[model samples]
Target: NATAKAELGRATWKLLHTMASRYPVIPTQDERAAMKQWIFLLSRLYPCGECAEHFQQMLKEHPPQTSSRAALSDWSCSVHNIVNARLGKKEFDCRTLSDVYKCGC
Candidate 1:
């Protein structure tokens, strides 16, 4: 039981980490405000409809930070969401998400 739980945790962490890494650090208010478009892109990573289509266009126009701490949390959150779907685990707590994505925030 402990081993299974540990593997699950590791897998979950990896997924969230990968996703979060897609964001940027935007150190200024202007930079932060400018991210509205990208933030929207992140929120609709899947379910390839107009939202996804639009997001893809934006990504091509301006690729993500790729290694930003600020982005890690967001990417991680998305990955976490997918992992939950696969594992049938409940979503991580908001506090947990906040902490995992501290660098991104």
Candidate 2:
């Protein structure tokens, strides 16, 4: 169960970060609001209850940055780093995110 939870978390984070990477550089108000709402919904609906609670708290403490694709991507990386730190995982170099998460979508 724990291994399945971990795998789900990894897949979710990858999907989120890749989406951020492909977001519009200059998003419309509707687009920005939709993105924020999507994250909120994801946090609420995450499969793991404890992880969902933690992510909701993180959202309150460090809200999503949806001004631009780059900003959102950076925000995603920073939040992932927070989760990684809590799990005793090695911190990723956020500066390399532009090169790291391009999905070519």
The best candidate in terms of TM-score: 2
lDDT of 1 by residue, 3-58 (tens): 76557567545654644544445345555445545555554754435435644555
For every model shown, what is its TM-score relative to the native structure? 0.35, 0.96
lDDT of each: 0.52, 0.94
- Which one wins on lDDT? 2
Each prediction's RMSD to truth: 9.9, 0.8
Off by over 4 Å in 1: 1-5, 8-67, 94-96, 100-105
Q: Which ten residues in a row have the lowest lDDT in candidate 1?
A: 18-27
C-alpha lDDT of residue 56 in model 2: 99
Quote the lDDT for 1 in model 2. 89
